[model samples]
Target: MKAAAIFGPGDVRVMDIEKPEPGPGELLVEVKACGLCSSELGMWVDPNFKTDDPIFFGHEVSGNVVAAGAGVSKFAVGDRVTIFTDRGGYAEFVTVPEDWAIKLADHVPYDWALGEPIGCAMNGTSRSGIEVGDTVVLIGIGFMGGLIQQGARLKGASRIIAVDTRPESFELAQKLGADHVIDAREGNAIQRILELTGGEGADVVIEATGKQGALDMATEAVRIRGRLVIFGYHQGGKRTIDVQAWNWKGLDVINAHERDPQAYLKGIRTGMKLLEAGQLDIAPLLSHYFELKDINHAFLLAKSKPDGFLKAVITF
Candidate 1:
């Protein structure tokens, strides 16, 4: 079997490894597509964050079940499935806990079945407290950012403001239902967001960039007493927040990352429902594809995020 591993910083290699068998209460999946996550960038390049063990880092994945271990009756062989696991997804095969594998409908595309990432964004949107007619601002319109914008709109936000440094994402943001797309390159994102909201800032501001600058901008762009959802995977470092500003505004800060199994399972189910209903479109958001053998290059492309590169999937 072949799999990708990060032996150390700046090193991603496709190498032969033993095929894993499903343990009791698990399933052995033949991976079809695995989505590259932004968090992998820091884990792949930063020495401080490097791990001593070889890391197979992809988490957003979809595949077909080849076999199910004892006690796994919820899914059967040949079922199309997506999984969220600790590791082992960037490979030709992976072992998923039966509970972690969400069976997909026959019509679900392998790439669109990348429900783990969608579930993540759904968790953040749920935390954002966006209401009908509420003004919502999303910072950093990357893949997750873009999807969350659509989620906000679906949740009935009247005004959706999308922010990002990449001009390439503006059009997609608008297409995703952002009424206003602010180019952060202009250096007055906060002021402009304030202006767009008639000086009150947004009712809900989601910090999705994972950058310190975007976090600071989100703090300033959120209205007093409004909910501030932190959705970014803030790489590997310390980011100081403006405690004074937050105190003055009396903001409701929510760190929105779901780790519990039940939470993840519930979110994944909801994400699948939204995708089936055409409420959340994963098509426009998937902009690049690569093969498993080119996993290293794929990681580079994901890190660079060249124009039109919102998300990259390693297709098996």
Candidate 2:
């Protein structure tokens, strides 16, 4: 078996390694596809972030089950599955608890089956308490942000506003069901959102940029008594927020991370159902694909953000 291991910043190498066997109640999956997330880039660039011994850098994974350990009953050998977790996926094989391995439907494509980020976005959006007929503002139009926009539309948001510095991202957001797109770099985003919402700030504001400025903007763009959901993984140190603004508006802040596995499972089921019903199309979101041997090239392409680069996948 071959796996990409991270030792330190700018130090990732693919090396032959012993295949992992399933422990009790675990299953071994022969990975077919894995998606590179932004958090993985942060971990790759930051020297302070520590990983598990012999770190394998991936979470969104889809594959087929080759073997199952004792006490596993829900699935059998040769079943197609997806594994969602914090790490240990950028390899030919990954061993996980049976509970974390979700069986995929026959109609689901192997590449698209690795749609774990959609589930995360769903969980975060649901927790933000988006209401029907409410004006919603989503900052950032990356992978997670795009999915959040789709989820907000599905939730019946009256107006969906998307903010991003990149013109391509804003365009993609519109295609993903955003009613309005704002180029934050071009002008005052907060004022534009307020103007569009009829002088009353957005009913729900979500910050998905993971940048300090975006966080501050979210705090300012939300309406009085509105909910603000922070779904981005902020790699930088402490961020400053205007205490006076939040205090005066009586706003509710919610910090969402991938913690609820059950919630994620439910979201995955919903996403699959939507895909099967042709109500949601994620195929357009996939930007690039690379073979397992070209892992370093894949990382470089993701960093470069070439045209049509939204989500990059490494296929087996």
Clash totals, every prediction: 0, 0
> How much lDDT does each candidate structure score?
0.87, 0.83
Model 2 reaches what TM-score against the true structure? Answer: 0.93
Candidate 2 structure quality by residue, lDDT tens digits, 76-159: 999998777654788999898888877888887878876578778777877878989989999998878877888888888999
* Candidate 1 pairs with clashing backbones: none
**Runs with alpha carbons beyond 4 Å of true place in candidate 1:** 48-53
Displacement of residue 100 (Cα, Å) in model 1 is 0.7
Off by over 4 Å in 2: 47-53, 260-263
Q: Residue by residue across 1-316, what tens digits does model 1's lDDT show?
A: 9998887666888888899989999999999999988877877777666565777768888999999999998999999998887766899999988888888887779899887889888877887888999999988888898889888988889988898877778988977878888899999899999899899999999998888998889889999999899999876669999999999999999998988877987888888888877788899989899998888888788877787889999998
